[model samples]
Target chain A: MKLPRLLTRPIAQPPPHPSAQLVGDLAARLEASARRRLGRGLALRHIGTGGCDGCALELIATRNLVHELESLGLRFVDSPRHADALLVSGPVTRNMREALEQARAAMPEPGFVVALGDCAVDGGVFKGSYAVEGGVEAVMPPDLRLPGCPPSPRQVLEGLLALVEAQA
Target chain B: MTPAEFLRQPPAQGPTHALTEPQWEALAADPELPLLALWGEPGVVRAAFQDGNALRLVALAAPEGQYPALSPARPAAALFERAVHDLWALEPVGTQDGRPWLDHGRWPVLNPLSGRPVRHGGAPPQPEFLPAEGHALHRLPLGPILPGIGEPAYLHLAVAGEAVVRMEARLGYAHKGVLALMPGKSPRAAARFPARLQAEATVAHSLAFALAAEKATGTEPPPRAVVLRAVMAEIERLSVHLHIWAQVLALAGPPALADQAALARETMLAASQIAFGHRLLMDRVLPGGVALDLEERGLSILRDALLLLAEDLPRLARATLRHAGLVEALTGLGVIPPALAQDYTAGGPVARASGVMVDARLGPDASPYDELELEIPLHPEGDAAARLRQRIAETAESRRLLAVMLDSLPDGPIITPLPQRGGEGVALVEGPHGPCMAWLALDDGGLIRAAMARDPAWALWPLAEAAAAGAGLEQLPLLLAGFGLTMSGMDL
Candidate 1:
């Protein structure tokens, strides 16, 4: 019996997975370099401020088999206390301003913030709205800024790897 | 009464009608008309109702800054009324729950949407949750910053031991003041807001917004654009359903199946990126038409993705069912009663699983859907398993539709220019989660005068509260994952 192409393909096939040839050699090397530098994995605690779920969806996609940051020494944690970085998305709204600060404060020493998506980086299209308080920088300093209305799963992985490598 | 019978007294062809105060109250009292959405603008308050095949809007003058509350009779109008009050300061007289819905008193100015905005002074007051009175019941607050990659919204679960006595969600933490931001911008410029309303349902929201803009401007997208829009919407539904399926399986145990489902979702996202130029299909659908027409490369990519999904989906479903533990975990958990679902006018898989047949795609005036062979999957079980099965069935149906659409692809100009003129329009599209509705009034110069995009999560969130009753606290995440409602979608 003939098997499907996806199932038949070997699990580890360099970088190109299925459709979009997103994960290339650079992403893999960054993953390895970050892992070596940190001596462990990076744990992220994500918080959504006031933007759309575009960035959040990409973040979730990074956990899928194609990207699977978990296998490459990056993971998401439930509490801020367990996190090594606070990955925040969206334009910081007034309502979530305090919550974002509290979550940032809860992170241990040497921990940094990664602002994901254009909204987080500079409030994107929602900038200057009465409710929005600009971007992550408006509330707290961000160690890394990944741009794109929402950076794709591949972009998100590369950004995280770069952040870990630089910080470590 | 059937929707046809409910619309026996047909309203005019236009979107809105000015009604007297008494007429507005009488219409609100009428059981036949289910309140689709409510919003306030300046001296007038508008309410939309699904009138058989068409959308009907009724406006009442609120010159004194207050109007008779529809929530007193409609129940579904409660959140809409609260949101209207929060944004416009148009008080809902005699509202059962007058607490702010979207505005947490955190904005710099009060009545931000009102023509005359007032600056706020002191720090915002703490939000009050509905009190739960019972012995041994303690309150547990969940979020505003939830686990994993989900959006933020505060959930207060009143629990006695492990069982949840009651659950209340405090939303608006993810609100971006989308309505307030759209007024001065042109339709082309404002299109981004609705598409970003919910990432998972971007195509659906964009399509609805585009349709509303098109209607307001009296423009029709070419046949190819219509067909392409349908294809994109179907792909979004397929992708989101798979994502939810994976999350549910991951929580229910069996990581292998979850991995397979996630892989399938990733493949779909890749196809979307290749075909539509955006993974989530955001900003692809615009007021005039689609941003880009599908070329040979995109078509081939989509064909390959569909072929792969066809082979993988059924196997994944079968493997999921083979696990007794997974089946047991999902079955009979988070059941939403059909009556309650109908009361709140739930749509999409949630309503279908509850035996309340409500899919905007299946409505009489659902254009491209009317042309395509569509199936409304229904299950009386109304539990987590039922919802999962609904998605699987719908995904299969979407795959079939995509194949059919690809085979009979139309050739034409993808867009038509919109005329710069004053008009009002409303549109409803069946999204991944449910039916998303968009209402907009364009100024004479084609700039947005007022707009409101209502996500189905607004209705589904209340049903989530209902489904959480009597469930163990640990099951809350699984239950929410099954529903897959977006906080940003509803908050906007």
Candidate 2:
């Protein structure tokens, strides 16, 4: 289908502050150093059990143009076996507990799990649900947590980079 | 509109029974029965169904909000009375059990609703945990503190190995008094609160709230606003469906499914940026109409993205259906009977998958829906596979509807300014997870008197009890995904 044309032009946006840019650049250098030294080959894998899909969407955006997480040589893998770090989102549901455990078990030794978003960190509001199994801590211990309703992709990238540094 | 006509006025006793004034006169005068299902939210009609026999008055309250304890009956009102006492601080004159149902022991202040300190001079009701007794009963404690996901609630499970004998869930962790907060804000501003209840379905919630306000005030949004609302609602549906579908893939653990999920997510991000200028579309829906309007360019971007989604969704769905292991895992797990669904008044795909064909958009005499051409899909098994199938089918249907609505886009200004004075109204929208109902009651000052949103998770949460029976621990993820219950919506 032919798409409609833009009715109005978007306002020009300002660039990030130099201080913020420097911080981002330093973070990028740290991630690179970690990948070369302590973390020679570690891939990130995203997992979503039964969340609203908000966190998962943000994670996907990390690899896109804006965040460019892939430029740091960070690749998102599909299986836990090849993953050096696991980025799990949502409260683990009762139905998903066993599979989650099995996935965690499949992860290589020394690999870490990062519970992303408010839902994953502590099960946020879904703490006492019958259908839910509880937060990531209930399913598997996490090395780090990035909290927010759905953390921004920039924040997610920063957190992931920080995780790599910790591993180093 | 006559009060009797516009409102699904409850019978003299309840919705099921009509008690004429003289018969119920004394009770009404005495405030013996708390009003039930007083507000209408778009697709769902909540009626306070009386629970228990005489001697106590308990109500299976729906829509949203705690029904005040009715007097005249004592023992029967214990649960209702206790629930109200803990939730909204509506104390019943006489009650049996009072140990706070909601007090988690750490609330900083007296629950503003209760007017007393969190823990004070009042005699605490004897704490009574659910008894676990049955054939080979074993307690399976899920979470007051869990691993991943939002909200804080607990499930006390009485199980024999893998099979659940009985399951009871303790919720209300995210109760921010959304209803109590609603009555004081202007409807236009109040609309923002409900939209964020569940981030993914923000537009659906906002639209539902706005529709209710419009209905109550006897105002129709401009035709363009209607079309915009439809577009926003459909886009919201598409984004959520893609997300839910991705969750199902990730649960199934198939590589192809993961790739498909990534693609779907990309489509959602792109479409969101083009339409509402935000991936989640939060606060874009206003009381009178949509806060943001998509002009020609934005519409084109969405159309292109949707075309790709429509093309790809079917292939992924087929792959999911044909995958042997995935099919085996989902086929008959978590089956909720039609009778149970009706009792709970389940809405959305959970109800539809179980043969309950109540779609607020297409129900009898439903305007707009009556004029719109669409298909109503149903599956009777109510199993995991059936629910997944329903989601896929609905996704396709919603996509088709979106394209049609866009093609015949209405012409006019995007918003219809609301009058300064507001009125009571209710609206319902079929959210991705299920039907989301928002009720708005304006105070005399044109501020929101009460705003309560009922997410589909309320009804589906109970079904988890039934779904857990006889299933091994390994298959729960697919079973839960099949239901597509939203945790945030449930918490609210």
Candidate 3:
């Protein structure tokens, strides 16, 4: 009797870069940005129009034990106006359009948007539904799109971190 | 057939109409009046029942036209009856509200079978606004169509100066005729739809379907498969609870709890990676057995992961509870008092949070759950805080269970073959969200008769009514977060 392959595959190798110089430049810039925005803190808020809740799940996970995202000082806020970054999920249904617009408008300036999951990126399988308005991109341009049926919490955290640095 | 005998039999045949006197008495004593059962054929259980006074009804998915109309007895059944009527074109004996459930007003359609247009045209009626009754009594119209983070639902709040006098909910935006979609597939293949029914409880859905199929076929997955399924299910539960807890925290305004949320995500991904190879653990579960096995290394990884999570989960739990704003906002708000929780047929942590000791796995007469020593925690408070606390405690227990199951791991063939003529089956598994039930019927050729997945929220929706009571219009966000019902589960 044969045993099935049960071990999880390893992460794929990332694209190559100019080793030492690229690392130094990236690290220096990231540190500089972090230092500049140290006390202000980034406020994160998430909205789910109608995705499978995968992104929402991962977003929540990113804040917990494995990801420990709070170490970076990113916080979630209630109102969009209080947020420095908006994490959006779902395909932006017709019913949710007004709320989405209201949230976007309420956000303070110098904010970035992170689109989580395939639904937010392209509406995935739910695209053709009459009530669906396609992806979040259909409603507003996203600064960073973290793609996955629902990206891992670490991926979401990384995306948020990258957006904050870029904005900073 | 006696209820005991019927319960013992695989859920293959149309539900045995014969009921023992005690069983009939129990059914009769149900607080909800008017449970109508329809059996269009010998072996299909298409039942509809409801509580007329509560203004809610439950329509179990079944063969087309087999669902009966309880609208004559219960006003709430009127909406569901119309929905079933529109989708399957199944004629309800008598329907009160003629408005269609799934049909969006454009009714006339060319009937290919009759070669004529079938139309039910009615004059568009004037929109009568909610009438004010007396001094300080005015209707606060919310939305059947609102924005932000929810499926299409309308809320009608009768308020006077920020105080709610009455609340009503209108839902059906995401309904996709799932019951109508289940026929024609094999029982095993049909099992696929249930997990998707409520993505959060996918593992529970998978387990219930598999268990039901197992019971029908008179086979259980090898010992190893059972343990693996349990491990995977627990991990899935942890993932969802963590998500719910974080959302509750965020909704109550604590930005710092994202760390806990991230940790929960890590646990979910790691467990899925260790057990099934996919993050969401999709397609990993199959009828009769699991598609993958736990290799030695994967087992160790799981053992280690569970240990780590168990050690660290407490701090995250404490942080959320200790947070001043969260406690103040959630402590007494959105209470699903014990009595109401039961009336709503609430399941999972929501039901447990309200002191109901109902769990599919914990039933003494049940299988795998009967084999394992299951401990359920119940609280009588039944508020948002209790629900959150219940989740935290359950997360710890789930971690312990996963660790134990992995340590006592069994080894054997991963997948079990489905006989050429797969049979009917039904499963009831306790999920993190609540009781998740899956039912399947296979044809002689192994094709599916009907597959249905019922989420705990089917019962918990009424609790929303209780939670919405007295909640001001502005507190809608907290109320929604606290109730935490999954719209996708019902929509599918």
| Clash tally, candidates in order | 0, 47, 24
lDDT of 2 by residue, A92-153 (tens): 75545555677788888666778898878987555554345567998777767789767877
State the lDDT at A110 in candidate 3.
56
Error of 2 at B165 (Å): 2.9
Question: Which digits, one per residue and each the tens of the lDDT, describe model 3 over residues A1-168?
Answer: 643111233222231222344335544654654533423358787877655566665675565544556667688776787877778876675546666778789887756667788878987556655446778888888766778866776667666655544444
Candidate 3 TM-score to native: 0.72
Q: Give the number of the best model, judged by lDDT.
A: 1
Indicate the residue-level lDDT of A90 in model 1: 94
Q: Which candidate is the best by TM-score?
A: 1
DockQ for the candidates, in order: 0.72, 0.10, 0.16
Off by over 4 Å in 3: A1-49, A60-147, A154-168, B1-45, B48-68, B71-82, B91-154, B176-182, B187-192, B215-219, B253-258, B261-265, B315-328, B473-476
Span of ten consecutive residues with least summed lDDT in model 3 chain B: B50-59
Candidate 1: C-alpha RMSD after superposition: 3.9
In order of appearance, the predictions have TM-scores of 0.94, 0.71, 0.72
Residue B327 Cα positional deviation in candidate 1, in Å, after optimal superposition: 1.6
lDDT of 2 at B108: 32
**Per-residue lDDT over B1-492 for candidate 1, one digit per residue giving the tens place of the 0 to 100 score:** 443253444556556777788777677677576777888898789987765435667788999999988887777899999989988889998888989988888888998988899999787888888888888898888888887777889999899999999999989998888988899788888898998888888889899999999999898889899989999998999999999999998898688788889889999999989988889888889888899999999999999999988988988888887789988888899888887876777788998998888788876338787877677778889999899889988889999999899887799898888888888888989999988989899989988999989898988889999899889988888898989878887888
